[model samples]
Target: MAGSVQPRQLALALPHAESLSRDDFLEGPANAAALSLVDSWPDWPNRIMLLAGPEGSGKSHLAAVWAGEAGARSTTAHALTAAAVPGALATGALVVEDLNPSGFDERALFHLMNLAREDQAFVLITARVPPAAFQVELRDLRSRLRAVPVVTLLPPDDRLFRALIVKFCADRQLSVDETVVSYLVTRIERSFAAARQAVELLDGEALRLGRPVTRALAAELLRDA
Candidate 1:
């Protein structure tokens, strides 16, 4: 955040992209319900919320925003444990993205639920699919997951698609012309996830060329994609 330049211009430009903030995320029909749930936090009937959507549908983006706003903590389902909960969560909130994406750690999650409930802290979980559709091996965890409030996001629309590409370019200080942007939107994969991946590829190509993006390179990426 301080004295940082573009990643390609400087070998060490903050090293990693900044956390996805509220401004970086674009809202569309696919994301309105998820946005509303977070917007109505603490009054949304349940302090515990579950978010799931297609891969790269901005679930982690929303999770990070919520974590920042609430000063909440998080642990991937892989590393979560009971001892980890009710520590700093009571004063803030807790988010577990990709919950059971790898596999459900039922014992750890169940313990976390009890602790969060006791502490009156918020607990949010996210995955690529709804819990109902999650391929769970543990019956107890499956049953508990079904009871949680699940929010799903639709595939991103054009506005969201454009916004994500622009933000990616802006973040890297890469100057991409309107023609190139339009070309990417039209020829590249249209989903938010696809746009992000395409941007990364295009950004890397721009860095290698040490010049602004041109329609020619974009066309090549689209052609080769």
Candidate 2:
């Protein structure tokens, strides 16, 4: 008993870099339209566009891909202000991400849209919900948001869901096979967030237990979850 080494007390929280490049993007029916719009670029139906999707639905990934190609500067809706609008669009392309009705400045956003129109700059706005759903106090801003072409990303289907599980595991450098993947696909929620979560949990548990990732390990880890 005295010579027995205790199991590792904690799993190291190692960071993993996720590629947001065009090549790393996983295309599927859920995101085809959004990907197409990002690829369309300067030829967009409108200079200002809204990308609407649920959390972890690849909205940021697609935005990053577009930003790389368009030389766009990125800012969050909460960080946007009337004073920042001019400099924000200095690159002729800007990404205003995570727009929430309660948090962002309505006047500043209105000014941004107006200035972007006048300067012919391309504005890509990302939000969890469609902008029309925002309880905007500014009538003009409301109208402007409605006029902007909306591209929505839907939940991943079976094929994409499986692909996402594999990619997420790969991102964490976790070696998972079809057995583990198949087990997870049926057990976890059908969304990007779920796949990412499942992999992170498996990775952490595997590290803590000093066990290889496999169907048996996954079952034991996820049995209570």
Candidate 3:
């Protein structure tokens, strides 16, 4: 018994955290600029504002916060069509997400931009890259997107990364320690996506093996990655 590992006694029900709300957002140096820009919306110098960031860099979460504040309707670039733009714009505040240059509808987006401007609607566009990098076939659309002010979300730093991991763990009701958090922060790549994946892998492994979340378990689960 002395040499054997002890199994953690977890609850029958998974821990439930509050829904993804603005209050849950952790604003540190990594995301403060982006957050500040988002907070300063409606008073933006330009009518169209672009939010760009790498995958899982909190762009969507921040967009959600903006949506709640402005009572905006949100959709992805692929889903935005010439036909759907009118209905989408009816919300007055609109968020068009993942507006990459490749495989996007330039005409539809151009139209949405024009409509948003005409209607005085506040538009928030999100993408993985800045609008300057997006390859727009339509010169008019290119010019339009280029004119939109851009805000970039930098990847999460250690503070934000650890906070995100803790939030992810709490969402799954996984009781992880500071040691595990600190361990994963150093071992894993510094990205929101990576943190989420690590937490997910550890949580699933712990549940499957009926073991507590430990440094050893984390090392085992993320060793290959």
Q: Which has the greatest lDDT? A: 2
* Model 2 pairs in collision: none
Superposition TM-score, candidate 1 onto the true structure: 0.85
lDDT of each: 0.77, 0.92, 0.84
> RMSD of each candidate?
6.5, 1.4, 4.6
In model 3, which residue pairs have backbone atoms overlapping below 3 Å?
Answer: none
For 1-225, candidate 3 gives per-residue lDDT tens digits of 779988765635354453558888888887887789778877788878888888878788888899998999999998889999999989898999888778578889889999998999988888889888776788988888788888888888778888989988887887888899989998998888888888877887787778999999998987887
Estimate the TM-score of every prediction: 0.85, 0.96, 0.89
Query: Which structure is stronger by TM-score: 2 or 3?
Result: 2
lDDT of 3 at 27: 83
Model 1, CA-based lDDT? 0.77
What is candidate 1's lDDT per residue for 1-225, written digit by digit as tens? 889875655332233374487876778888999988877776867878888887878788888888877788877877776676666475658888787545656777877776777777898888877778676666777787788989999887888877778877777777887888898888877776787778777777767766568889888767967
Q: Considering lDDT, which of the candidate structures 1 and 2 is the better prediction for this target?
A: 2
